[model samples]
Target: MGQIYDLAIIGGGVNGCGIARDAVGRGNSVFLCEMNDLASGTSSWSTKLIHGGLRYLEYYDFKLVRHALLEREVLWQIAPHIIRPLRFVLPHHAGLRPAWLLRLGLFLYDYIGGRKLLPPTRTLDLTRDETGKPLAPGRFKRGFEYSDCSVDDARLVVLTARDAADRGADIRTRTRATEIRQADGMWQVTVQDTATGDRSTISARTLVNAGGPWVENVLAVGAGVNAKAKVRLVQGSHIVVPKLYNHDRAYIFQNADGRIVFAIPYQDDFTLIGTTDIDYDGDPADVKISTDEINYLCKSVSEYLARPVLAEDVVWTYSGVRPLYDDGANEAKAATRDYVFELDLPGGLPLLSIYGGKITTYRRLAEEALQKLAPYLKGTKAKEGWTADAALPGGDFDVSAVDALIAELLRDYPFLTPAHANRLAHAYGTRAAKMLGTAKSPADLGQAFGATLTEREVRYLMANEWAVRAEDIVWRRSKLGLRLSKDEIAVLDQWLQANRAQPANPMREAGARS
Candidate 1:
């Protein structure tokens, strides 16, 4: 027998990382293994909104909405740099749901979670409001504005993993928990390091199957359980294109089919539009954004925009599946985003399975997961909901007070352009200091990789976060790939080849949290 843990997490997406952080903070030994990079799965391919999902309100999921909205403020407070409040403009159109219903929805949304930080909704005369300048004038008249939050979903997952590590949790990326079996009322889990092809066994009293799209498959195949819950995997895809508008405001469009889509401002020069929901089967790892999805998304957005968008306009695309709790909704869009916890527990050892979850609801999801496992663990009060006050890594600044901090950071780093400084602050929050390291000048920051990406930033990623591949730095850590060229990407790949560290030895047990 090697090291024993209180928790062994099967996935390294946001939910897994969030749970690991929660368990570690509760003074439990934890080991987490992700087969690929963190957020390499569905967690990164999100529409990237941290909101109550306004549409869910139509379904009358008041409980889910309240929890998600409350978590939104909590997350924004913890990582103000990464998660920030956003305003959405819904343009009133003819032949759609009545304005009275829309007003009622927005009114309830404001009051859903005891609104505090976010401004309340307002009616907008689209013809006069600045939010309607780009719209085709006669096609729209009135509109509504509401609050939500946007996030760098991948970085959020990584930061939670980082905090868990800082608190003494053992995290392994590019490692797969290949198999799990029960013996003596404890779990004997085998994990394989993909890079080295070495395997090691870990023991845990609890095994959390937090796999997102692969949750059911993991329960049935990997964890060797014949029984499982009702879950449906629905694939959702997002497409990024050149910025269509020049405002901080995002547009929430209602489709002809009564489905809604978002056209949100992204990465300074791009707008992120998405999410076509379709049933998916087969391996979650091999899921891809298809041409049909491209057409559907383009057509849907084109119907509402002044200048119609086409497939050729897309610069980047991402797709992933949502593990929705099977609520018997035949329509893919109608499936629930709320999560359900199922236990494959045997002999009092716990195997908790998580179904669907929105980015806004991860913290409460962790709390509930622990509550379900409370009886088995025998320490019900060890770590009871402390995330509200704690900041993740560099996110200690006031969420509303970020403008002043960004202004100060800009003054301190005169070499950084105003826009670049804001980008760094948003990506790393207060941790931008760590990314800068001791580089006193632009030259000292190492070779400029591309866009604002520098060698120093790369080194910082490798040293602190598990940034092993070029995509890890580009696509997830920062959206610099949207700005970098093929040549710049090649250089980072070459640099990683020469400098990337080997996966930590499975034989060598972790000594500290980080």
Candidate 2:
């Protein structure tokens, strides 16, 4: 066996990354491999809301809703820059879910999570409150206001990976584990780097499969066996358009079929509406937003909005398949978003697999997975769980202090514009100082890579963050690609050609072993 690892995790989604962060913090040497850019899968395709799942109350999923609602605050305190409180408006309808049921659900939502910093849910007068200004007369009479949190899903995954690496875990993005086998009481794994087509091998005491929608695929194709082949795949899609209205509050409108739709303020200039449930059977990577889904979502929004949401209004759209633990639910909409863990000690080498988890409960899911697989470690010792209070990378400061922190940063470097300072604060939080360094003026920053990206940030991403491809910088590390010109992207491509790392003649990396 090669150098022993306490855990080797496949798939760099939120669940895998969170487990890496948690396991490494517990003194377990870890190796995490991802086939594509980190969080490039379903982990990044969520509606980007971290709520207590108020709608889940209808199905008696009170436990999940309460946990999610509670995590809304916990994660906000840890990563205030990327996560913040947002108000949602539930317009009272003449027919759908009676006011009494909605009221009781709100009451339980507030009390179930042990209500804290967030404001309590309250009755709204659609005609009086500023939140109801853009409504059509006679359409909206009353509503309710409740609190939830929005997140940059990609960054959350990256921060988890960053924290795990800082804790001494080795992260291998753009690398795919081709095969795993148990030999002589140890697990042998072969990995191929997708970029350069380089292959190598490694060995670990335990293997973890957290491949999100590809969980079953990994077990069948990579592990070469159908282990726990009792999972279901359900597709959910979202669409983006120019911000529909100027209100800061979101609207949740129930459709004719008892399903709900959300119209949210996105990127300060766009509105994000989504999520239609459809049964999926194809490869997850190949899933795309269908025209029917687009029409369905738009019609749902049209039912409540003063302005109808037409297909032309959609600027961007995406789709993701949720790997649900099949509970034999007939309807995709009624399926559970909760997770399950399957631990098998084949050849005395433990393999822990994960399935069906939402963003809100990833941390707790990681803790539980660790405990479930703890006994498999045998005589080898590992740290106990303690990630609850720990601050993730750049999340040490509370949200209340963000303004003060930004003010101090700007005071030190007056040359930086407010946009630059805010962007840095948003990406790096207090740790923006490390990226800013001693640059006194804009010229001190390296080449302009478009959007708000500076050369300095590029170098920082290459050195600290596991940024490899140009797409990694444009899409994941930063959303600058959405705002940059074509010429600017060309410049980034040129810069990447010059800075590509030279691998050894052996044609293998240190972490590649079978």
Best-matching candidate per TM-score: 1
lDDT, candidate 1, 1-514, per-residue tens: 7777888999999999999888888777888989899999988989998998888899889899888888888899899999978999998777888899999999999997877888889999988888888787578899999999999899999999989998889999999877888886788888899999999999988889988887766676557675557778899899999999888999999988888889999988999998888998888778899999898889987887788999999999988988889889979888888988888756557889888888788888888888787676643347477777889988989887678767877777778888878888888787776566555579977778878888777877776788999999999998889998999899999988987764331112212223
Q: Which digits, one per residue and each the tens of the lDDT, describe model 2 over residues 1-514?
A: 4677878899999999999998888778899999998999988888998888888888899888887877888888888888878999998888878888899999998899976899999999999987777666677889999989888888899989988998789999999988887776677788899988999888788889999888877786556455764678889999998888987899888898878889899877789998898899998999999999999999998888788899998878889888888878889888888788888776566788888989888888888888887776542355467777888777888778888778978998898788778878877886687677777888887677766688777877776677766777887777666677778888887887787673121101112110
Q: What TM-score would you give candidate 2 relative to the actual structure?
A: 0.94
User: TM-scores, in order shown?
Assistant: 0.95, 0.94
Q: Lowest-scoring 10 consecutive residues by lDDT in candidate 1?
A: 505-514
- Model 2 residue-pair collision total: 9
The residue ranges of model 1 lying beyond 4 angstroms of the native Cα positions read: 378-383, 502-514
User: Residue 53 CA error for candidate 1 (Å)?
Assistant: 0.9
What lDDT would each prediction earn against the true structure?
0.84, 0.83
List clash counts for every candidate, in order: 2, 9
